[model samples]
Target: MSIINPALERPELIAYFLGANNYSWLHFRNGEKKLLSKPISYLEGRLPGFIRVHKTALINPDYVQSLHRPLRQKMAGKIQLQSGETFPVSRRRWNQVAQSLGEHLSPGNNEEPLQESVYLDDARPTSEQSNLGRSVASLFLVTSDEQNAFLARQVITKNWPDYRVETIPKSIHLPELLDDLAQSELPVLVFLDARSDTLERLQTLQRLKNDPRLCRVPVVLLALPTDKSVIEGYERQANSVITMKEGDMAFAQVIDRICQFWLKIAELPAHC
Candidate 1:
């Protein structure tokens, strides 16, 4: 698709895209611009892989420096730009975006060469699998620190032996991550840490839940204190919220619940 240049008619107009709502702004070189008032839905279909990471900017994955995963739902990783600007990657879109990055780096894509270690496990399963079921499931774990990320991976691998678990660093670019998620298959589950800020995280969750493409993907927020009021608020957008301090058995139980929930959704008879 061709890039939309509203400046064609108004030669002085500059174009800026925002992903928060998927709207673009047409600005004149003279510093005046009007919000296009178009729904992000339209742009989501036409824009290339990279998109607006926030309400005020568009990002290309090629330019991303790193992705940081925050430990709490409210605070996800900030996308570091080549220009030194930081953008937020909503917990909801983290997995999708990480998958997209892997694809981009895969052979035949424009991504740079992979390190030897990444190639060492080429034969490994890309998605998780199990004798318990036939379908493969993708899990995205959002953590605040490397230790948690490692722990989460260990838990997932031990319990859901057959599923593919993609652990995204919170420092990556949000737009790039979402682009990846957009291309993945159904039955994706995202685990968000609850220790982070809730307002921004909720906004991100709301956006992901609202997207028809990603709406079905379940989002489970991980809360430590396990406040009832907080849980209720997140439940509006999250599939479920489980406390990490609840011990290994409880953690496993929560994972099982999520697995069951997603499996049920995946098994629904298709209309198509």
Candidate 2:
């Protein structure tokens, strides 16, 4: 449970290890974090029973609280700890990690139920009832701004726990997105940021629409409340144009509504 810090020559109990490049951060149970003068690979060899969930994260099963797996395999699963910290489980490492933490994972909650909506159609037949549950789709937000990506992800995860939000920074290759989505087993929704680079994002949207593989995927444009931007977005084949709100809370509500309609009401194509 304790390891001697090579530099400090003292024993320290670690909750987990987060690695960045050559350095590793040692997180303790008391919410204390120390920058260790060693790589996570070094600690892996030294510490026993610490699970390497991701390439950059190593966790102690004793501190694990629960494991969250998506209904679809397209998105990576996450490991939540008792300290309220979460780490991503990479697709390649998922099977190994799941088997290792088999006894620690919570039961009947691996796939959390979606938040109940007032408008769910309860009249669907038993054959179609399987698809009425939480969505297995992924949302790809295309933007260069880090804050925009963070806020969108925060909003999407809060509203739809089963859906995954991935940020595709600026200068993305449309063909690459198409190829990746083509290989995925589930569908994907694209959100283009048109607030700043209106023309460029619209062009990207046009490219997406022209591609046969991605043409069926819904592409929504996040833009300012300008008439020109909205008009341009539609001309380029954007499925929907959402105007940005003044405050963070209001903006998040906007995203929440988007999730309600796209992931809840609308039926997407089987493959993106």
Candidate 3:
């Protein structure tokens, strides 16, 4: 029973042993416990903002104390935890992990200062982009897996380029994240990954959709390959449903389409 302290910037979460895989077992944590019979890969896109620090650990950057790039050749850098547990950071994800932590520490520093541009693309109007410059869109993604959240961030960085992206794993409670989202003035987009069969996922979605306070903010359901058939059910409640294979282009297209729709509605003539 490892307990996370409150002084640490990371959220307090618990991990339940889901089952055993070849290398690692599945885990889910909130205030209480729930185990899964599935593999960790099945929860990849489902956990928001979490990253696989080691074969057995999915950690939220908030709880990370520091990154240790050891001089030893065989060992990669490790992410030190407040609990004193060091999770190995793979060579492939070193840069990405560092960048994500850097961005979190220094917000609004990555993008070029918003400047006036006369040039316009055929797909969107100059005024549209200009307006977008004036307003910021912060997409807060919630998934059950860190890798998938990073994937979403990569797609967003490649396509939107102008917006900011942050991810949190499902290990943190949905209510807590929603509270933070409500505090932010920017347009908040919540991407929920369909991973766990736990009632929390469905219950949270239902509550958010029905809550008048949160219903207007866009919520996207990221469906797994196996969950394709259930997407239609979510569409009625979610602003959009995105399948895993659709990739970045398709995901960006969906974001652009929704933004355009919102802009049109906002700019509508009073008489109409």
Candidate 4:
């Protein structure tokens, strides 16, 4: 018998797995996918926490937002994830899926679909773009450096036009920022630059993580390319630590990828 380390498994980070024949596609919370050579049977035996919802699908129970069943038995049921992606639940698997989501299921109108925006990949066509209904989320770039803020804005404007960028100085009062973010009616993400006041920035990051109201909001630390800086940022509970790169073009590319992943790919928590 093999014991899976909780740290290594990080099952919460995985959304589900879709398998066919000898291959499997691993979907993540960040909207990233990985093709594995192993079959579904192989993974089902090895992974402990995943619930086999369908012949081809294995979902992490933690990510299951709800189980949706139609009024009539005309079609199969669905397992809706917090990420707004839904997977089919065969008739045979309905009982099993419901039992697995016993306590976790949201206690609203089961017949009504979530008002929150659905991904384009959803079975029901809500919109042409992903997260269409809730695209006006605020993105905060906490940096004293004007150049860094300008570069991030350019990339965000070009990639995520719906996202609004707000530049905040690192020296701002932590409590004021937290209070403002806690009252926000939309999703929020923060980018902190540690190039200048690295210690002060890390302290601010720690404070954000410690606050329960705003802890779910993703905070990415922009640190110098050093082991110490990266390690410290993680220790302070930064969601992600990206190293600062030289030159405008190179850094802009990095910012582009950042915007793509956070604003577009990753499913953010409903802060409101």
Q: Give each model's clash number.
A: 25, 0, 12, 0
What tens digits encode model 2's per-residue C-alpha lDDT throughout 178-249?
443334533367777777767778877887788787778898898888888788888988899998743345
The TM-score obtained by model 2 is 0.48
Better candidate by TM-score, 1 or 4 = 1
All candidates: TM-score: 0.48, 0.48, 0.40, 0.47
Clashes of 3: 12
Q: Pick out the ten consecutive residues of candidate 2 with the lowest summed lDDT.
A: 115-124
On TM-score, the candidate that comes out on top is 1
Q: Which ten residues in a row have the lowest lDDT in candidate 3?
A: 113-122
The per-model lDDT (C-alpha) reads 0.49, 0.65, 0.47, 0.65
* Shift in Å, residue 4, candidate 4: 57
lDDT: which is higher, 3 or 4? 4
How much is the lDDT of residue 32 in candidate 3?
46
To one decimal, what is the Cα RMSD in angstroms of model 4 from the true structure? 16.7
Q: Cα lDDT for residue 24, model 4?
A: 83
Query: Candidates ranked by TM-score, best first?
Result: 1, 2, 4, 3
lDDT of 4 by residue, 1-272 (tens): 13223312777778888775688888888898877777888888878668886677788888888777632222245667888766656545566666667766667713343222101111222221454445355576777666766776767766777665655554334433344322553247888888778888988788778877767878888888899999999999999999975433466577678878876789888665
- Supply the global lDDT for candidate 2: 0.65
